[model samples]
Target: MHAIVLVGGKATRLWPRTRWQPKALVKIGHYSILEIIIRRLRDCGFDRITLCIAHLGDMIKDEFGDGRHLGVAVDYCAEERPLGTAAPLHLVPDWTSPAVVMNGDILTTIDFADLHRQHTTSGNLLTVAFHKSLLHAGVGVLRVRDGRVQQIWEKPNVEWNINAGIYVADPRVRDHIPRSDAADMPGLINALLADGQQVTGYGFSGQWYDIGTPFRYQKAMKEFLTHPDRYLRPDAPSNGNGRRNEVALEPDGDRLSVADLSPWS
Candidate 1:
Protein backbone atom coordinates (compact mmCIF):
# COMPACT_ATOMS: atom_id res chain seq x y z
CA MET A 1 0.00 0.00 0.00
CA HIS A 2 1.07 3.58 -0.54
CA ALA A 3 1.57 6.08 2.27
CA ILE A 4 0.98 9.83 2.31
CA VAL A 5 2.91 11.99 4.75
CA LEU A 6 1.72 15.53 5.45
CA VAL A 7 4.92 17.61 5.54
CA GLY A 8 3.50 21.09 5.30
CA GLY A 9 2.72 23.04 8.43
CA LYS A 10 3.72 26.62 9.32
CA ALA A 11 5.00 25.19 12.65
CA THR A 12 4.58 28.59 14.22
CA ARG A 13 4.60 27.03 17.66
CA LEU A 14 8.16 25.79 17.02
CA TRP A 15 9.38 29.25 16.10
CA PRO A 16 13.02 30.48 16.07
CA ARG A 17 14.14 26.94 15.17
CA THR A 18 11.47 26.02 12.61
CA ARG A 19 11.82 29.55 11.30
CA TRP A 20 14.36 27.97 8.91
CA GLN A 21 13.38 24.30 8.66
CA PRO A 22 10.17 22.35 8.31
CA LYS A 23 8.85 20.59 11.40
CA ALA A 24 9.41 17.20 9.79
CA LEU A 25 13.05 18.10 9.46
CA VAL A 26 13.36 18.73 13.17
CA LYS A 27 15.80 16.17 14.54
CA ILE A 28 14.86 13.79 17.31
CA GLY A 29 17.76 11.76 18.58
CA HIS A 30 19.87 10.89 15.56
CA TYR A 31 17.11 10.99 12.95
CA SER A 32 15.03 13.80 11.65
CA ILE A 33 11.36 13.35 12.48
CA LEU A 34 10.67 12.77 8.77
CA GLU A 35 13.33 10.09 8.56
CA ILE A 36 12.01 8.29 11.62
CA ILE A 37 8.45 8.33 10.31
CA ILE A 38 9.47 7.21 6.83
CA ARG A 39 11.56 4.42 8.28
CA ARG A 40 8.60 3.25 10.31
CA LEU A 41 6.42 3.20 7.22
CA ARG A 42 9.07 1.24 5.36
CA ASP A 43 9.51 -1.13 8.24
CA CYS A 44 5.85 -2.03 7.92
CA GLY A 45 6.36 -3.04 4.27
CA PHE A 46 5.02 0.19 2.78
CA ASP A 47 6.47 1.82 -0.29
CA ARG A 48 5.33 3.98 -3.19
CA ILE A 49 4.90 6.80 -0.75
CA THR A 50 3.57 10.26 -1.51
CA LEU A 51 4.66 13.33 0.41
CA CYS A 52 2.12 16.16 0.35
CA ILE A 53 4.21 19.18 1.10
CA ALA A 54 3.57 22.94 1.21
CA HIS A 55 5.86 25.12 3.30
CA LEU A 56 9.55 24.30 2.71
CA GLY A 57 8.29 21.54 0.47
CA ASP A 58 11.27 21.46 -1.82
CA MET A 59 13.60 20.84 1.08
CA ILE A 60 11.63 17.73 1.94
CA LYS A 61 11.64 16.66 -1.69
CA ASP A 62 15.38 17.17 -1.89
CA GLU A 63 15.99 15.18 1.27
CA PHE A 64 14.05 12.07 0.41
CA GLY A 65 14.13 12.18 -3.42
CA ASP A 66 12.50 9.07 -5.00
CA GLY A 67 12.93 7.19 -1.65
CA ARG A 68 14.94 4.39 -3.32
CA HIS A 69 17.88 4.92 -1.05
CA LEU A 70 15.58 4.26 1.85
CA GLY A 71 14.05 1.13 0.28
CA VAL A 72 10.92 2.83 -1.04
CA ALA A 73 9.73 4.72 -4.09
CA VAL A 74 8.94 8.26 -3.04
CA ASP A 75 6.86 10.76 -5.01
CA TYR A 76 5.71 14.22 -4.10
CA CYS A 77 2.69 16.46 -4.59
CA ALA A 78 3.35 20.11 -3.82
CA GLU A 79 0.46 22.26 -2.62
CA GLU A 80 0.57 25.90 -3.66
CA ARG A 81 -1.23 26.78 -0.47
CA PRO A 82 -1.87 24.98 2.79
CA LEU A 83 -4.56 22.39 2.21
CA GLY A 84 -5.90 20.90 5.39
CA THR A 85 -5.18 17.23 6.17
CA ALA A 86 -7.68 15.46 3.93
CA ALA A 87 -7.49 17.73 0.90
CA PRO A 88 -3.96 16.93 -0.29
CA LEU A 89 -4.99 13.40 -1.15
CA HIS A 90 -7.03 14.92 -3.95
CA LEU A 91 -3.87 16.46 -5.38
CA VAL A 92 -2.12 13.10 -5.76
CA PRO A 93 -2.76 10.88 -8.75
CA ASP A 94 -3.15 7.12 -9.21
CA TRP A 95 -2.97 6.06 -5.60
CA THR A 96 -6.34 4.39 -6.12
CA SER A 97 -5.62 1.67 -3.57
CA PRO A 98 -6.39 2.22 0.10
CA ALA A 99 -3.63 4.36 1.57
CA VAL A 100 -2.16 5.23 4.94
CA VAL A 101 -1.98 8.92 5.81
CA MET A 102 -0.12 10.48 8.72
CA ASN A 103 1.11 13.76 10.03
CA GLY A 104 4.78 14.23 9.24
CA ASP A 105 5.61 15.57 12.65
CA ILE A 106 4.59 12.62 14.77
CA LEU A 107 6.75 10.00 16.47
CA THR A 108 4.99 6.74 17.12
CA THR A 109 5.61 3.03 17.44
CA ILE A 110 2.14 1.96 16.30
CA ASP A 111 2.17 -0.73 13.63
CA PHE A 112 1.20 0.84 10.30
CA ALA A 113 0.68 -2.41 8.42
CA ASP A 114 -1.63 -3.77 11.09
CA LEU A 115 -3.64 -0.57 11.04
CA HIS A 116 -3.97 -0.76 7.25
CA ARG A 117 -4.97 -4.40 7.30
CA GLN A 118 -7.54 -3.73 10.00
CA HIS A 119 -9.03 -0.88 8.03
CA THR A 120 -9.41 -3.11 4.99
CA THR A 121 -10.79 -6.08 6.86
CA SER A 122 -13.35 -3.98 8.67
CA GLY A 123 -14.47 -2.63 5.31
CA ASN A 124 -14.61 0.92 6.59
CA LEU A 125 -14.48 3.96 4.33
CA LEU A 126 -12.06 5.37 6.87
CA THR A 127 -10.39 4.13 10.05
CA VAL A 128 -8.47 6.23 12.53
CA ALA A 129 -6.08 5.08 15.21
CA PHE A 130 -7.19 6.56 18.50
CA HIS A 131 -5.84 7.04 22.02
CA LYS A 132 -7.52 7.63 25.34
CA SER A 133 -6.62 10.20 27.97
CA LEU A 134 -7.98 11.04 31.39
CA LEU A 135 -8.31 14.56 32.74
CA HIS A 136 -8.81 15.61 36.35
CA ALA A 137 -12.52 15.38 37.16
CA GLY A 138 -13.89 16.77 40.38
CA VAL A 139 -15.50 14.45 42.90
CA GLY A 140 -19.25 14.35 43.30
CA VAL A 141 -20.88 16.01 46.34
CA LEU A 142 -24.29 14.79 47.37
CA ARG A 143 -26.61 16.68 49.74
CA VAL A 144 -29.24 14.50 51.30
CA ARG A 145 -31.77 14.61 54.18
CA ASP A 146 -32.17 18.12 55.60
CA GLY A 147 -29.38 19.52 53.46
CA ARG A 148 -26.83 17.42 55.38
CA VAL A 149 -23.76 16.19 53.42
CA GLN A 150 -24.67 12.54 52.87
CA GLN A 151 -21.85 11.57 50.50
CA ILE A 152 -18.64 13.01 49.23
CA TRP A 153 -16.70 11.09 46.63
CA GLU A 154 -13.57 12.22 44.93
CA LYS A 155 -14.43 13.12 41.37
CA PRO A 156 -12.73 10.97 38.78
CA ASN A 157 -11.47 12.60 35.65
CA VAL A 158 -13.51 11.90 32.55
CA GLU A 159 -12.05 9.59 29.94
CA TRP A 160 -11.46 11.26 26.63
CA ASN A 161 -10.42 9.74 23.33
CA ILE A 162 -8.68 11.43 20.42
CA ASN A 163 -7.55 10.66 16.91
CA ALA A 164 -3.87 9.79 16.56
CA GLY A 165 -3.44 11.51 13.18
CA ILE A 166 -2.95 8.14 11.56
CA TYR A 167 -5.60 7.20 9.05
CA VAL A 168 -6.54 4.71 6.39
CA ALA A 169 -8.73 6.13 3.65
CA ASP A 170 -10.55 4.89 0.59
CA PRO A 171 -9.82 6.78 -2.59
CA ARG A 172 -13.53 7.48 -2.90
CA VAL A 173 -13.38 9.61 0.21
CA ARG A 174 -11.63 12.20 -1.93
CA ASP A 175 -15.05 13.18 -3.19
CA HIS A 176 -15.79 14.84 0.14
CA ILE A 177 -12.91 17.33 0.01
CA PRO A 178 -13.49 20.60 -1.81
CA ARG A 179 -11.32 21.66 -4.74
CA SER A 180 -10.08 24.56 -2.52
CA ASP A 181 -10.21 26.21 0.92
CA ALA A 182 -9.43 24.93 4.43
CA ALA A 183 -11.43 21.75 4.11
CA ASP A 184 -10.34 19.71 7.13
CA MET A 185 -10.01 16.05 7.95
CA PRO A 186 -12.14 16.01 11.10
CA GLY A 187 -15.02 17.65 9.21
CA LEU A 188 -14.75 15.06 6.49
CA ILE A 189 -14.77 12.27 9.06
CA ASN A 190 -17.83 13.82 10.70
CA ALA A 191 -19.57 13.97 7.34
CA LEU A 192 -18.81 10.32 6.74
CA LEU A 193 -20.09 9.41 10.18
CA ALA A 194 -23.31 11.36 9.65
CA ASP A 195 -23.89 9.74 6.26
CA GLY A 196 -23.63 6.29 7.83
CA GLN A 197 -20.45 5.62 5.99
CA GLN A 198 -18.25 3.02 7.66
CA VAL A 199 -15.83 4.80 9.91
CA THR A 200 -13.88 2.98 12.59
CA GLY A 201 -11.53 3.76 15.43
CA TYR A 202 -8.61 1.52 16.32
CA GLY A 203 -7.20 1.74 19.81
CA PHE A 204 -3.42 1.90 19.85
CA SER A 205 -1.33 1.60 22.99
CA GLY A 206 2.08 2.67 21.81
CA GLN A 207 4.51 5.51 22.12
CA TRP A 208 3.16 8.51 20.21
CA TYR A 209 3.93 12.19 20.26
CA ASP A 210 2.88 15.10 18.07
CA ILE A 211 6.07 17.12 17.56
CA GLY A 212 4.50 20.42 16.62
CA THR A 213 5.69 22.74 19.36
CA PRO A 214 9.04 23.46 20.97
CA PHE A 215 8.07 21.74 24.20
CA ARG A 216 6.85 18.61 22.44
CA TYR A 217 9.81 18.77 20.13
CA GLN A 218 12.18 18.82 23.07
CA LYS A 219 10.31 16.04 24.75
CA ALA A 220 10.48 13.83 21.67
CA MET A 221 14.14 14.58 21.18
CA LYS A 222 14.93 13.74 24.76
CA GLU A 223 12.91 10.57 24.73
CA PHE A 224 14.48 9.30 21.53
CA LEU A 225 17.95 10.21 22.67
CA THR A 226 17.57 8.55 26.03
CA HIS A 227 15.93 5.49 24.56
CA PRO A 228 17.56 5.33 21.17
CA ASP A 229 17.01 1.62 20.72
CA ARG A 230 13.28 2.13 20.82
CA TYR A 231 13.21 4.32 17.71
CA LEU A 232 16.51 4.25 15.87
CA ARG A 233 16.85 2.45 12.54
CA PRO A 234 19.31 -0.35 11.99
CA ASP A 235 21.38 1.67 9.56
CA ALA A 236 21.37 4.70 11.86
CA PRO A 237 24.44 5.22 14.00
CA SER A 238 24.19 5.76 17.72
CA ASN A 239 26.52 8.75 17.62
CA GLY A 240 23.50 10.81 16.61
CA ASN A 241 24.46 12.56 13.38
CA GLY A 242 22.05 10.57 11.24
CA ARG A 243 19.82 13.57 10.66
CA ARG A 244 22.59 15.91 9.63
CA ASN A 245 24.19 13.22 7.49
CA GLU A 246 20.96 12.46 5.66
CA VAL A 247 21.05 13.10 1.93
CA ALA A 248 19.13 16.24 1.05
CA LEU A 249 17.03 15.73 -2.05
CA GLU A 250 15.79 19.27 -1.54
CA PRO A 251 15.91 21.93 1.20
CA ASP A 252 13.56 24.91 1.43
CA GLY A 253 12.40 27.10 4.29
CA ASP A 254 9.01 26.09 5.71
CA ARG A 255 7.59 29.58 6.29
CA LEU A 256 9.33 31.17 3.32
CA SER A 257 7.91 29.92 0.03
CA VAL A 258 10.54 28.76 -2.43
CA ALA A 259 10.58 27.54 -6.01
CA ASP A 260 10.43 23.80 -6.66
CA LEU A 261 13.89 22.57 -7.62
CA SER A 262 12.96 18.90 -7.82
CA PRO A 263 14.21 17.20 -10.97
CA TRP A 264 11.38 16.04 -13.20
CA SER A 265 12.20 12.54 -14.31
Candidate 2:
Protein backbone atom coordinates (compact mmCIF):
# COMPACT_ATOMS: atom_id res chain seq x y z
CA MET A 1 0.00 0.00 0.00
CA HIS A 2 0.97 3.63 -0.31
CA ALA A 3 1.90 5.87 2.61
CA ILE A 4 2.62 9.59 2.63
CA VAL A 5 4.81 11.04 5.36
CA LEU A 6 4.69 14.82 5.94
CA VAL A 7 8.17 16.11 6.72
CA GLY A 8 7.93 19.56 5.26
CA GLY A 9 7.47 21.81 8.27
CA LYS A 10 10.19 24.14 9.55
CA ALA A 11 9.72 22.69 13.04
CA THR A 12 10.34 26.11 14.53
CA ARG A 13 9.91 24.81 18.04
CA LEU A 14 13.02 22.63 17.66
CA TRP A 15 15.28 25.53 16.85
CA PRO A 16 19.10 25.40 16.61
CA ARG A 17 19.12 21.65 15.98
CA THR A 18 16.29 22.00 13.48
CA ARG A 19 17.84 25.23 12.32
CA TRP A 20 20.34 22.97 10.58
CA GLN A 21 18.24 19.86 9.82
CA PRO A 22 14.61 18.92 9.49
CA LYS A 23 12.95 17.34 12.53
CA ALA A 24 12.55 14.03 10.68
CA LEU A 25 16.31 13.83 10.22
CA VAL A 26 16.90 14.12 13.95
CA LYS A 27 18.29 10.85 15.28
CA ILE A 28 17.10 8.64 18.07
CA GLY A 29 19.97 6.32 18.93
CA HIS A 30 21.44 5.35 15.55
CA TYR A 31 18.39 5.64 13.31
CA SER A 32 16.94 8.89 12.00
CA ILE A 33 13.32 9.39 13.04
CA LEU A 34 11.92 9.04 9.53
CA GLU A 35 13.98 5.92 8.82
CA ILE A 36 12.57 4.21 11.89
CA ILE A 37 9.05 5.18 10.85
CA ILE A 38 9.58 3.75 7.37
CA ARG A 39 10.87 0.47 8.73
CA ARG A 40 7.85 0.10 10.99
CA LEU A 41 5.52 0.92 8.14
CA ARG A 42 7.31 -1.54 5.87
CA ASP A 43 6.89 -4.26 8.43
CA CYS A 44 3.15 -3.66 8.32
CA GLY A 45 2.87 -3.75 4.47
CA PHE A 46 3.34 -0.16 3.26
CA ASP A 47 5.76 -0.59 0.35
CA ARG A 48 5.21 2.56 -1.70
CA ILE A 49 6.21 5.69 0.19
CA THR A 50 6.08 9.38 -0.61
CA LEU A 51 7.78 11.99 1.52
CA CYS A 52 6.03 15.36 1.56
CA ILE A 53 8.84 17.83 2.16
CA ALA A 54 9.50 21.57 2.04
CA HIS A 55 12.00 23.04 4.50
CA LEU A 56 15.40 21.44 3.87
CA GLY A 57 13.68 19.11 1.43
CA ASP A 58 16.79 18.65 -0.64
CA MET A 59 18.59 17.34 2.40
CA ILE A 60 15.79 14.84 2.95
CA LYS A 61 15.94 13.84 -0.71
CA ASP A 62 19.68 13.37 -0.34
CA GLU A 63 19.27 11.30 2.82
CA PHE A 64 16.93 8.68 1.37
CA GLY A 65 16.99 8.82 -2.38
CA ASP A 66 14.47 6.38 -3.96
CA GLY A 67 14.18 4.65 -0.55
CA ARG A 68 16.04 1.65 -2.07
CA HIS A 69 18.48 1.67 0.84
CA LEU A 70 15.58 1.10 3.19
CA GLY A 71 13.95 -1.61 1.01
CA VAL A 72 10.97 0.52 0.00
CA ALA A 73 10.06 2.46 -3.13
CA VAL A 74 10.63 5.92 -1.76
CA ASP A 75 9.64 8.97 -3.78
CA TYR A 76 9.07 12.60 -2.83
CA CYS A 77 6.50 15.36 -3.30
CA ALA A 78 8.19 18.70 -2.84
CA GLU A 79 5.95 21.59 -1.88
CA GLU A 80 6.74 24.63 -4.00
CA ARG A 81 5.21 26.71 -1.21
CA PRO A 82 4.22 26.02 2.37
CA LEU A 83 1.14 23.83 2.49
CA GLY A 84 0.15 23.29 6.06
CA THR A 85 -0.69 19.69 7.02
CA ALA A 86 -3.55 18.41 4.88
CA ALA A 87 -3.01 20.73 1.93
CA PRO A 88 -0.05 18.72 0.64
CA LEU A 89 -2.35 15.89 -0.30
CA HIS A 90 -3.01 17.63 -3.58
CA LEU A 91 0.58 17.09 -4.65
CA VAL A 92 0.49 13.32 -4.18
CA PRO A 93 0.32 12.09 -7.75
CA ASP A 94 -2.24 9.52 -8.88
CA TRP A 95 -4.74 8.74 -6.17
CA THR A 96 -6.43 5.35 -6.61
CA SER A 97 -6.47 3.72 -3.19
CA PRO A 98 -6.70 4.68 0.47
CA ALA A 99 -3.26 5.77 1.67
CA VAL A 100 -1.88 6.14 5.14
CA VAL A 101 -0.98 9.74 5.90
CA MET A 102 1.04 10.80 8.92
CA ASN A 103 3.59 13.28 10.17
CA GLY A 104 7.24 12.22 10.15
CA ASP A 105 7.89 13.48 13.67
CA ILE A 106 5.81 11.01 15.64
CA LEU A 107 7.07 7.85 17.43
CA THR A 108 4.42 5.26 17.99
CA THR A 109 3.80 1.51 17.69
CA ILE A 110 0.55 1.91 15.78
CA ASP A 111 -0.31 -1.15 13.71
CA PHE A 112 -0.81 0.28 10.24
CA ALA A 113 -2.16 -3.03 8.91
CA ASP A 114 -4.85 -3.06 11.54
CA LEU A 115 -5.69 0.55 10.85
CA HIS A 116 -6.16 -0.18 7.12
CA ARG A 117 -8.20 -3.26 7.85
CA GLN A 118 -10.52 -1.28 10.06
CA HIS A 119 -10.89 1.42 7.44
CA THR A 120 -11.78 -1.09 4.72
CA THR A 121 -14.36 -2.76 6.88
CA SER A 122 -15.95 0.43 8.11
CA GLY A 123 -16.12 2.04 4.65
CA ASN A 124 -15.19 5.40 6.11
CA LEU A 125 -13.92 8.21 3.94
CA LEU A 126 -11.40 9.11 6.63
CA THR A 127 -10.05 7.26 9.64
CA VAL A 128 -7.64 8.95 12.01
CA ALA A 129 -5.55 7.42 14.73
CA PHE A 130 -6.27 8.96 18.12
CA HIS A 131 -4.64 9.00 21.52
CA LYS A 132 -6.04 10.07 24.83
CA SER A 133 -4.53 13.35 25.98
CA LEU A 134 -5.35 15.13 29.20
CA LEU A 135 -6.72 18.62 28.66
CA HIS A 136 -5.76 20.87 31.57
CA ALA A 137 -7.97 23.91 32.02
CA GLY A 138 -5.37 25.79 34.01
CA VAL A 139 -7.41 28.87 34.89
CA GLY A 140 -10.67 29.05 36.82
CA VAL A 141 -13.53 27.69 34.72
CA LEU A 142 -17.02 28.65 35.85
CA ARG A 143 -20.43 27.81 34.42
CA VAL A 144 -22.76 30.49 35.74
CA ARG A 145 -26.52 30.80 35.45
CA ASP A 146 -27.12 34.50 34.68
CA GLY A 147 -25.50 35.62 37.95
CA ARG A 148 -25.31 32.51 40.16
CA VAL A 149 -22.53 29.94 39.60
CA GLN A 150 -23.97 26.63 38.51
CA GLN A 151 -20.66 24.80 38.29
CA ILE A 152 -17.03 25.66 38.87
CA TRP A 153 -14.05 23.40 38.14
CA GLU A 154 -10.52 24.41 39.13
CA LYS A 155 -7.69 23.04 37.07
CA PRO A 156 -9.93 20.42 35.68
CA ASN A 157 -8.36 17.46 33.91
CA VAL A 158 -10.52 16.31 31.06
CA GLU A 159 -9.69 13.32 28.86
CA TRP A 160 -10.06 13.99 25.18
CA ASN A 161 -9.31 11.97 22.05
CA ILE A 162 -6.61 13.83 20.21
CA ASN A 163 -5.61 13.33 16.57
CA ALA A 164 -2.50 11.16 16.57
CA GLY A 165 -1.16 12.81 13.39
CA ILE A 166 -1.99 9.66 11.48
CA TYR A 167 -4.74 9.02 8.97
CA VAL A 168 -6.13 6.51 6.47
CA ALA A 169 -7.92 8.52 3.82
CA ASP A 170 -9.82 7.32 0.81
CA PRO A 171 -8.84 8.71 -2.57
CA ARG A 172 -12.21 10.40 -2.88
CA VAL A 173 -11.64 12.30 0.33
CA ARG A 174 -9.11 14.54 -1.41
CA ASP A 175 -12.05 16.17 -3.18
CA HIS A 176 -12.82 18.05 0.05
CA ILE A 177 -9.51 19.95 0.07
CA PRO A 178 -9.45 23.36 -1.56
CA ARG A 179 -6.43 24.40 -3.63
CA SER A 180 -6.74 28.07 -2.67
CA ASP A 181 -5.48 28.21 0.93
CA ALA A 182 -3.28 26.28 3.34
CA ALA A 183 -5.21 23.79 5.41
CA ASP A 184 -4.73 21.41 8.30
CA MET A 185 -6.20 18.07 9.36
CA PRO A 186 -8.76 19.64 11.68
CA GLY A 187 -10.22 21.72 8.87
CA LEU A 188 -10.38 18.70 6.59
CA ILE A 189 -12.19 16.64 9.21
CA ASN A 190 -14.67 19.42 9.84
CA ALA A 191 -15.37 19.73 6.15
CA LEU A 192 -15.92 15.99 5.85
CA LEU A 193 -18.32 16.17 8.77
CA ALA A 194 -20.22 18.99 7.10
CA ASP A 195 -20.48 16.86 3.97
CA GLY A 196 -21.87 13.95 5.98
CA GLN A 197 -18.98 11.63 5.14
CA GLN A 198 -17.92 8.90 7.50
CA VAL A 199 -14.94 9.73 9.70
CA THR A 200 -13.69 7.35 12.38
CA GLY A 201 -10.98 7.27 15.01
CA TYR A 202 -8.62 4.44 16.00
CA GLY A 203 -7.15 4.82 19.45
CA PHE A 204 -3.89 3.11 20.38
CA SER A 205 -2.49 2.31 23.82
CA GLY A 206 1.13 1.96 22.77
CA GLN A 207 3.86 4.53 23.30
CA TRP A 208 3.30 7.80 21.37
CA TYR A 209 5.58 10.80 21.38
CA ASP A 210 5.85 13.96 19.30
CA ILE A 211 9.50 15.02 19.15
CA GLY A 212 8.97 18.61 18.13
CA THR A 213 10.95 20.00 21.06
CA PRO A 214 14.36 19.23 22.58
CA PHE A 215 13.02 17.95 25.89
CA ARG A 216 10.45 15.73 24.18
CA TYR A 217 13.04 14.42 21.75
CA GLN A 218 15.41 13.49 24.53
CA LYS A 219 12.64 11.87 26.53
CA ALA A 220 11.41 9.86 23.53
CA MET A 221 14.92 8.73 22.72
CA LYS A 222 15.35 7.51 26.27
CA GLU A 223 12.08 5.63 26.14
CA PHE A 224 12.87 3.99 22.80
CA LEU A 225 16.35 3.09 24.00
CA THR A 226 14.92 1.58 27.15
CA HIS A 227 12.60 -0.61 25.09
CA PRO A 228 13.56 -0.57 21.43
CA ASP A 229 11.99 -3.93 20.77
CA ARG A 230 8.58 -2.64 21.66
CA TYR A 231 8.39 -0.18 18.78
CA LEU A 232 10.29 -1.92 15.94
CA ARG A 233 8.68 -4.93 14.35
CA PRO A 234 10.55 -8.06 13.21
CA ASP A 235 9.28 -7.99 9.65
CA ALA A 236 11.47 -5.23 8.21
CA PRO A 237 14.70 -6.02 6.36
CA SER A 238 17.89 -5.61 8.39
CA ASN A 239 21.58 -5.30 7.65
CA GLY A 240 24.00 -8.10 8.35
CA ASN A 241 24.24 -8.90 12.02
CA GLY A 242 21.12 -6.71 12.17
CA ARG A 243 22.44 -5.28 15.39
CA ARG A 244 22.87 -1.58 15.37
CA ASN A 245 24.30 0.43 18.28
CA GLU A 246 21.60 -0.68 20.74
CA VAL A 247 18.24 -1.65 19.24
CA ALA A 248 17.88 -5.23 17.97
CA LEU A 249 16.13 -5.19 14.60
CA GLU A 250 15.82 -8.95 14.62
CA PRO A 251 14.60 -11.16 17.42
CA ASP A 252 16.43 -14.06 19.15
CA GLY A 253 19.73 -12.31 18.45
CA ASP A 254 19.03 -12.36 14.68
CA ARG A 255 19.55 -8.93 13.14
CA LEU A 256 17.62 -7.10 10.43
CA SER A 257 19.78 -6.56 7.35
CA VAL A 258 20.43 -2.91 6.44
CA ALA A 259 22.82 -1.21 4.06
CA ASP A 260 25.37 0.94 5.85
CA LEU A 261 24.34 4.34 4.55
CA SER A 262 27.73 5.54 5.76
CA PRO A 263 26.55 9.13 5.98
CA TRP A 264 23.96 8.10 8.53
CA SER A 265 26.68 6.44 10.55
Q: What is the lDDT of residue 45 in candidate 1?
A: 83
lDDT of each: 0.74, 0.79
Say which candidate scores most in TM-score.
2
**Alpha-carbon runs more than 4 Å astray in model 2:** 133-157, 234-265
Model 1 per-residue lDDT tens digits across residues 196-265: 8868777665567888777888888887887765554533332321111112223222211011211221
Clashing pairs in 2: 238-256, 238-257, 238-258, 239-256, 239-257, 239-258, 242-255
- Cα lDDT tens digits, model 2, 1-265, are 9999999999999898899999899999988999989998888898999999999999999999999988899988989899898999999987689999999999887778877878777788998887654456577555555576655556555545556899999988779998888999899999999998868777665568888788999999998897777568633322211100222122111111121111232
lDDT at 154, model 2: 62
What are the TM-scores, per candidate, against the unseen true structure?
0.80, 0.81
